[model samples]
Target: MAFGARARLINPRLGTYFSIFAALYTALFLLVLIFEQLKFDESFLRIAFLAGPIVIYAAIGLCVGTNDILCYFAAGRRVPAAYTGLLLGASALGGTFIVAGTGAFFFSGFDAVILLMGTLTGFVIMAIGLAPFYRKFGAFTVPSYLGRRFESRGLRVITAGIAAVPMLLVLSAELRIGGHVAQRLVGGSANNLVFLLALTIAISTAAGGKRSFTWTGVAQSIALFLAVLGVATTISVMVTSLPIPQLANGPMVRGMVRNEVNEGLQLIKVWPMAFQLPPEGFSALTKPYTQPFGSIGPLAFIIGVFAIATGVSTAPWLLPRVAATPGVYEARKSIGWATVFSGLALLTISSAAIFLRDFTLDAVMSERLGPLPQWLHNAAAHHIVTFDQAATRLGFAGLKFDRDGVLFALPLLVDLPSAFSYLLLAGAVAAALVTASATTVSLAAVLGEDVIQGMSWEPPTTQSRVWIVRGFIVVVAFCGAMLCVTAPSDPLRLVLWALSLTGASLFPVMVLSIWWKRLTVGGAIVGVISGFVAGAFAIMMGEMGTLSTPGAIAGILGLPVSFALAIGTSLMRPEVSRHTVEMVRDIRVPGGEIIYDREMQRLQLRKHSRT
Candidate 1:
């Protein structure tokens, strides 16, 4: 079993193989300091400058491109639709979604659990109601679908523009995250020109596309899941009986500590009826449930339902997977199970961390820390403190004064065994690679579908087209890397913004295109463009401290505006050709199987006619 696992984990490609070595080396380095007194220093210079960006980019390039690109080439022409779904799902596992969950954790605390339920609900509803139609259209790019639905060059341009801006930003965020992870691993020996690192990552990603991205995602998800599992499990065992922190420290303490603790316990208690929950406790679950349409909130439920329902087609990450395999439905059938298991696994890890976080914080505040030892950052609870400092205390060992840093600083203090430490560290690198590879390919496809082909530009040869795509990948990567090296933001924070923009903006447009037949060419074009602009507009505005509610609303209006514009305009404008309806009727085949029979049927018909 060990041998098989080793063989499976180790890749044959030079790039992947090199990354494996780096993982092992970094593990050894961490192992030496597993018991050390190193503090969590997350200053930009420490985290970003100290880490080598190019190498990290190169590593992800292997994971994302190799298998993903191979699978695409192997599919020949007219790629299967189901493979696209698989690829999309795989890509979905990257830093973006992980950070989305993290963002929810930050803003609303555990009370934000409702958001997770709502998100899942949205996906399920969309899948059952609208996925088939979106798949049927058989369009490869989001903009292509816009063209099919609206058929107006203006709409296509707008849709492309909408998709392009956020997509570029998304890529930038991934680079930032990947660079940070690389920097952390590289420790004292980071990189010079961050763009150089970005370009390196982009090149590797461009090299493989479908084949590489698929395998890389598989690698990233597996590595991350296992690493987090080990960490969460250890903490769980250590803190199973831990209680939520209460602020019995004073009158201010009573309101802040006790109420906070009590509310937290209500949200977390596995058995709800066992203990009485505060009135606020019940409301916490629905705090973010906005635009409620009456008591049971049928409208809100539909929002979740349709979001999930249409999620199947909106995420373009799945496209390469579709083109790679032979069976479409066969592949689609596998998604629910895959996502279910994966979601459960990740949730388990996340929940364990959350429980640990609350319990530990409470213990420290009340000075009830028995044998469990104060986490690294307990030093800074001082006269008055911030949650960031509280969270920082969760690390292995803290420098006397470094607890003021963000939650990401915990990584520097972990004390895993060499083997497992390397294994876990490898996972972060894997995450970067998976994302970089997927983004690189997706970026290439967009350029192909929207820029060149949209303009009636064609390469002189198949190879030339391939090279053009590769060239574009490198260029896009270069631009992203430059931003990473130069741009100033928390690496992980940067990733969150990237994913938030992409998902919030694009998801709505993709959702509308699927089932709402009234989602005319005009509608989809308007919707996608609106989603794009609204999402971007929010990100920039929020950054300037203009938005009053930091995360309470979470840009839900982006989706509504997208829907209203698409559907409203679709209804009002002269509808484009009925081609989009026809396209969706035919394009998709679910079940996610490896075999297809259409070619076989065609050959049989040809043979019979000859006879």
Candidate 2:
């Protein structure tokens, strides 16, 4: 039995299959590169190469289809820690992280580094505060766990509604960015590209559910990691004559800062005081380019960091990945691995942004309105790279940068081979699709299992439940795609909006539910609703185009109100049931599998009995 368990964990067949697929795709990519170099107008070849991998990935997902809800929902609770970690990290590193986040570093300078730090610290909070317990509780999803813990269907339904907001918003942002990438690669309508990408995601997600996303996420992570590392390393070597960009790019950055100052381009003090913003009327003062806290002062910056950290800790899509792990120990270990992966990706992205900025400055200064590079012209055509030549004498004129364009524009900015640019775009697409699929699954799970099932008069049959979940995947994907077409906010801002909502509304109650035995259903519901209202209002005020400071401090406004209301209301109300009390104790103990194992057996028995 021990040997069989170990073999199952190792899953040699899956490993071999993945290795073969990777080699095949790599060979195909190299072939396409060669064709391009031969001057064969490889537009068709490039599209074929890019589209083929996605189809193959979807086919693999379909091949792995399962009727078991346990498998569909949580991969049968048998995935090893390493795969779980990779999937979680990949899912977390969405299109926003890959495509728009680099632009953020270009725009916000070092202030954006705070957001990255908050994300890493969030995983630490998850590993220590949430993952082990959530695994031990053995719930299929976060809302389901909340319902069981609080012994209230209303709480489950409300949590589901609240959770859906951020999931849908984030999904829209992912689709929007994915569309931009597809447009860059294929040269088509952005809306059409989004619909196609959404269709692809829906098909892949509906076919194998969480199980498919797990394996595909591993592939996506590898592609993104390699693409980022390769681009950043290559650019760093070209710029500073050093291979390690994270270290060597400092001098380049310093040189850029000196040039900007000498040219009378407004810039804040470098290092330590990088939080200061440039004066108004600077062309670079776009959305996030404004003061970090607007009028809320420095304390708002600290609040923003904690808000993002809390959001990452309690995000609906991420919680299910942690629950899929086989045991508490593996769940905790998976978060550690996830942190390492995220840290490496973050390092690469930051370095890439810095290097690109320096490269762009040098290019513009050298060329000075004498016809820019081909990549810049392409980007300008797409409205990604704009130029403001009104102040050409300042030597910083003619360059208006958008954060969303930095990653995709980097290859062109440095004049790398066309094949490398294609590879990077593919990486961005992988990141977007992987995240969209995971979010779709999580959204479907919550809406179908938690909302629909909780509101049902009778328990849904296993087959009916599976169908409902699959149906929700299509519906959610369509809605997200539509929003992608209509939503006006940039990708990074959309992501920040979703995170701020989650941090303000869900994080407070989620933490207390596990740590505070006295937390009553009334308190949980009240806190969540109040936080949601406050957070939404704050966000709306910011969106109304009148209150910058209110939006910057939106999380601060909602979080404290929710925390206080929850604690105050819980003290006024009665404590929860004894079972709930003991469950809390159960989560804190280590190396236990009886709870999850029994749950799995129960699900298996139900699946077999129904058939």
Candidate 3:
């Protein structure tokens, strides 16, 4: 009872939750404010900007969900697919989408909104692969599923390795982009030193395990939803004229073509930066969407998406939630909705960011030249800080592309005050929390179940399991943080790089293993290897602007080649078991539904069919 009383006093959720919530926003907001008000050194701002996402992400990642058996509700079976998808969509969009997607997903300038929408729409169809099929198996992660299906440690080892790489790579991109977005939101210099940000994420992630991190997701997810709503409303009010922003950024581009307005739309000019005009934005190097083509054609885009979809499907982070769901149906429902929501957000947000980043140059100029009294301007305008030292600014900080005069892009981008902006930022932060929490918990699961005890064995005591996860959280966080020191500049590219790796290694094997009865272990091995190799090759080609166009054509081709090899080998060999074939029949339904049953007699009959 004494301990219980102490626990209540010390482990307060409501207050700590809100405080973290407020701090998350305030810390990020303050960084932007310093620049608008003080005109601080850009280097410092870059360095400083890294702090919030890392810290907030870490803090949220450590929040736990009590698993008193009751905590493991039958969400998987009970929740409708649509509702599950909604939650997933909302969760996957996280902080970055809120900041980058909503802030930038406008029809006015860069036509960025359109690009993101395309990605989202494509993903909607894509999520189907994961929902029923993955849910049916009742596996938590891609690798775990591989382990279960193959019953081959060799296969599981390779798959796990393949799956983990992309996650690590993408985490770097997320951190970098968060820093970039934060830098702009703060104005000039967030003083967020890169190491500071890295350290914060490391510390926070290391704090707890699955128990602590789930709530962090809840807190962050809630914050993100609210923030997006607020920002969405604010953007609506600011541009009462352009109804197009609501329709989708791409449509506006089409309208531009229809009205011949696109022909005359001049690129916004911000000093020290050059962005693309709408007519040929992809061709423009200065624009964020500019493909790293090195000189390749449009086909690279297709290849890139296919790889991203195939390679990065079963994130390590998404597994535990799969475990927690009530049954296969619930899990399916969640994944389907998750795909759509994430896809939409990715599309809308990406397009909006491109639009904002491109057009904001002009917006900056207008804000500067417009006739409002200087004093009447927001607080950011009233004060400005400047830094002179060159070497000092560049070291700890990150890149800041000032798209124009003093009123820079960051704060304007995030100044989520009033009704909408604040809410949006909150949402962005919340999303960050969700990803962080999910990732941390998933990592814990991996370490506790896979690495420490092997797949067949699980911890006997909840207390022991919790401690194992907590210990691993610290170790993993340290390693990941160290990687962030060498983080890259272009976040989008970085994300793709990691995702492509996944496409190469794991995509084909999983698909064939689930869909085809004749697929053999040898075939699975060949497919994983060949597909991975092709994926890597494709990524290089796409990045270099070489073999692409039908978009995802590379992935389509790569997987088939890999699958063919696997099947050819399987047919050549004799280990093709009747049991495996029977297992396949049990899972793959007309609509691809899976039902779980513990009844031993029925299970024996099901097993007998395989023999």
Per-prediction TM-score: 0.65, 0.89, 0.66
Residues 1-611, candidate 1: write the lDDT tens digits.
Answer: 74463344334363465457447545534544443334433343223322333354456546444322223333232233333433344355455344333433422343334334533453454356434434444344566555545555566555665555545655666665555445444443234434544555555556665454454454455555555555445444444432211211123222433434443322222222111111110111211111122122333333332333333335454433444433334234434544564455436434532443443344344344444343333313321112344342322122222111222322323433333433434455555556666666676767765677675422234465556666777777777666656664544334334444445566765655554545666566666667656756765665566853222222334666776787778778655556656544444444322222232245456766876
Query: Model 3 — which ten-residue stretch has the worst lDDT?
Result: 273-282
List candidate 3 segments past 4 Å from native.
1-87, 94-127, 182-212, 241-245, 248-298, 343-429, 455-466, 487-489, 537-558, 589-611
TM-score, structure 2 vs. true: 0.89
Which model is ahead, 1 or 3, in terms of lDDT? 3
lDDT (tens digit, per residue) of candidate 2 on 209-292: 888777766777667776777777877777678988778877776667766544445634333212232211113532222224
Expressed as tens digits, the lDDT of each residue in 44-138 for candidate 3 is 54434334444555655445333332232222233334434554555444443444334333222233333344345434534456545655665
Give RMSD (Å) of candidate 1 vs. truth: 10.1
The lDDT of each candidate is 0.45, 0.74, 0.46
Clashing pairs in 2: 103-403
What CA root-mean-square deviation does each model show from the true structure?
10.1, 4.1, 9.7
Question: Lowest summed-lDDT stretch of 10 residues in model 2?
Answer: 273-282
On lDDT, who's better, 1 or 2?
A: 2
Question: How far is 546's C-alpha from truth in model 2 (Å)?
Answer: 6.0
2 or 3, greater by TM-score: 2
Q: Alpha carbon lDDT of residue 9, candidate 3?
A: 30
Give the TM-score comparing model 1 with the true structure, all chains together: 0.65
